[model samples]
Target chain A: MEDEPSSRPAGRPRDPGVAARVLTAVQDLLITNGYAGTTIAAVAQAAGTGKAAVYRRWSGKADLVVAAVLALNAPVSVPDTGSLRDDLVECAMHYARGDERATRVLASLLSEIGHDPQLFDAANRAIGRPPVAALVAVIEQWVRRGAISADVPTELIAGIIPTAAFGSVTLRQRTLDTQTISDLVDHVLLPALTGAHGSSTQLL
Target chain B: MEDEPSSRPAGRPRDPGVAARVLTAVQDLLITNGYAGTTIAAVAQAAGTGKAAVYRRWSGKADLVVAAVLALNAPVSVPDTGSLRDDLVECAMHYARGDERATRVLASLLSEIGHDPQLFDAANRAIGRPPVAALVAVIEQWVRRGAISADVPTELIAGIIPTAAFGSVTLRQRTLDTQTISDLVDHVLLPALTGAHGSSTQLL
Candidate 1:
């Protein structure tokens, strides 16, 4: 859903505040009405903006929804703890601390996202790629230091916590507590990365 | 969502075939209309039965939909391949071979299921728990044989493949290919379970 900037009539310089208001409206609609029920017209009405204004920013519902979700998520800061285990634990903690409203919005989008390629790509770009990138960078540093094997599938290793965190909220309706996050890092991720059982006693 | 057999008026013996038809209707409607759009009356109409007939069988839409999804999935046969890796591979293969329509139905239910505890538990019973039980059984056998450490989180180990499979389909919108499954088992599951890097070369 690419915006055709040229197709839009030369209008007043876009209102910066309008975009934020529209995104907030989108998130609200997503939580209350879900993907199928949230329409452009409804979002525009909720935002107190004209339908044309919404379309001017986003090509369609998928584009708008993806933008809303992206805005909702604050980027995870990449931690540079010297140890791979510590870096991963920090990342996992960041994921576990995500707010419930954002989780609900994501859960509400899951059904529709799976079916729509555009939405799926948009969601992946917003929610999936950044954390994986951060983890990859950390793992690469460890690999360079010979702390972990170069043969490890870096992307797969990176995906574990995010996948688990996503499953915990979206599938099981549970938040990841500190104990569970500690267990995951100590028991699962460390061992997978280092080819040695995690020093659970040492870490805990 | 539990069926109250006692609550049914002393009526004609239940038509075994009606249950099947109603479940089929639910699957069809779920694929076409999604969870929010699918209604009990519409399902009954689609099944060529009265609403009473549908409700007598299931308490409501959540109950009916869960049954429909359960019926759509054939139970995974737990493999006793003598190797935990082999057993996990077989299970992963079964998951990879799941038909597209069933995947679509599950995808459609995800949004509603996350919000409704009854639906969430019903879905966990139907879709989440059985394969996990099978994996736990296999892992436990390995633990007993001393092939893996007893300290491994058995349930978490059991959950890895299913979680990956779910993430592959629901989040990425891609089915797990044979190579990807082999990589996951060798590169991720094997290491996490045994504290040894997967023999990717040997396994492949």
Candidate 2:
């Protein structure tokens, strides 16, 4: 790792494991105490690091919480299964099967996030944009192949699965099951993308 | 007003005005202090009433807040405009233009609601069910008219606009504008319902 010569205090080299420990501490504190309750001092204490070490990595609580939450949701690989339906289904399942602790932390953060603009922006950047980007990439491939229309609002269409998954956890207190994911892809995403309903018998 | 004869303590009949004041106070405190911060005693003080008055009406904080939120979102009348498109658009806009205070309260409650089973159930009944019920009613009307397939997951189709509107306010920090709502209806909702794309030119 490159040293931040200017920012680093002239001393012995930093502990290589501090960052991981601090991040893990942040998640634990967040899940237990929530956004308002989780403090840098508490995180540092839990991580067995100094407050200065935590601050050196992240600016403050918002930054730390956002980083912790982002880490909790490890990015799903964008599937290139040659079928948009399959890709979307895989994407939905990935979100539906997200870590329970992450869901709890996010649920706790939702309130604080609304009140704090900095936290909201940090969350939107760290948590919100990635899946949409992945979905957009998948949809664009179909558009290029002429299998889907060029005029599809790729961004809006891309938001459906992620938004649904979010609502499921944060509001409904459940994850979307496999059958529900398939139904969403075939009925909502597929129909919206292809302009054709899936399984006419299912529709009838 | 029908008195809760069993629950109400023997005293002068309950004041009709106290319920309204308590509810209004609950909204104000929720918006200002968030779920964890707002207490029943605080709400009583803000409303210039006794805690017993607040308790007599609702069991606790969750009930009071849920009632207040429900009151804030005055039920949208289900439109039967003789056109499914018009009806759906009307429903979407109704949610898009929801009370800002209600949105803030909800954003605050989201975290706490996940942890509290009673709050979750009360919120689902008070806040969540009404709009979905309204949308389901409208879609069922169309289904009866044979304009849309009977087998359409009316419940899922009904959920889209409201979910989008909720995500817009809670996550995106803005209401869905007319153009975005229209595009959602034309591109997503309508297609999913009718199995046909809207506007050939728009599709291209």
Candidate 3:
């Protein structure tokens, strides 16, 4: 069992990329074996590291999974797609494009995290918070432009966008089609959010 | 091990309640322990049956869990709440209330199912198809009422609702709260299903 070889340069050829390599392996294991089946040994074998190397940084199997999944699914800075709706669509579509296996891995981890809320606390912090915050910034621009409601709480509601988008797979027993996702954004989300008040009366 | 006491009798002898009791217990285990942790032995223990009894009814653990979840979350049926929006909200809220452990169980089963989708084919058949099927029924009612578009393909969109509602909990690391649930029915879902034209624009 060796200590975690940090990313910094090493004098003795310490295989400095071990941590990242291990995390990637963990991601693969999570996709294949699932959260419960994945073990420290499996991660070690996949990463080409000893058990001690894994233990140096992670407390247990759950810790390893949290790190690995967050590495893969954690929201990055929101892309500046120029339009709020377009940017949100791209964000939703990022998870939408066929990657069923990764979606399942994320779904499984979510189940585990729900049961044991703390399992991914750090991972959630590292991964869950940032992109939603970025989304908040973008949507706030909408609020200011009066294209959308200033009354809308972006932080609270914006979080739902990605959750609804990437979550499309778990939501559908099969896979999500393109128009369903577009409807989710254009119709369901915007109307309820903006209260599209007069449209209903006009339709009548 | 004792056999699963058959279906509950009219007066309740002959151990007729065995199947019902066992299915219920297994479902409870699914929420608490998740799919991996919910073993046949554990289900037997919780149901107060012998391991042999469980095997007699189910080929394996997956069958047992699928039966349990399906029985618990059966189509309770939705009332025509006048408007499509109201019907959708009521359905969303009803979908939200249930085994607090459902989100975790869903994540667990969803992840593992990919490795062997056939194993869950029975589950998909017996337990999986009904509730969402019921929601599709609700959507159809709205379309007939002209509250929603007949062209909406309500069945397809209805299918994604349960998955999205439950997935919201897992992915967001939050509970399926009423407002969020309502908003989903409102903001993201209703417009797509309702044919609310000009929902995104009105120069407000």
lDDT of 1 by residue, B131-154 (tens): 777778788888889998898888
RMSD of 2: 5.0
The list of candidate 2 runs beyond 4 A from truth reads: A1-11, A69-73, A100-103, A199-204, B1-11, B55-59, B66-73, B199-204
Root-mean-square deviation (CA) per prediction: 5.1, 5.0, 6.5
Residues B106-160, candidate 3: write the lDDT tens digits.
5556655555665356456644566677678788887777777776656556755
Sorted by DockQ (best first), the order is: 2, 1, 3
Give the lowest summed-lDDT range of ten residues in model 2 chain A. A1-10
The alpha-carbon lDDT assigned to residue B49 of candidate 2 equals 78
**Using alpha carbons, what is the TM-score of model 2?**
0.86
lDDT of each: 0.76, 0.75, 0.62
Task: Point out the worst 10-residue segment of candidate 3 chain B by lDDT.
Answer: B195-204
The DockQ figures for the candidates are: 0.61, 0.61, 0.32
After superposition, candidate 3 runs with Cα above 4 Å error = A1-13, A59-62, A73-85, A98-104, A115-118, A126-135, A153-161, A165-179, A190-204, B1-14, B81-85, B98-105, B118-131, B153-161, B168-175, B186-204
Interface RMSD to the true structure, each candidate: 1.7, 1.5, 5.0
Q: Is candidate 2 or 3 superior in lDDT? A: 2
lDDT of 3 at A44: 89
Candidate 1 lDDT tens digits, A1-204: 222244455774666887998899998998788787899999888888778888877988778888898887567677887767778777777666756566667777877775677766667776677767787888888889999888788888788777777777777666777777777777777788887665656554
Quality of candidate 1's docking, in CAPRI categories? medium
Tell how far residue A180 is off in model 3, in angstroms: 3.6
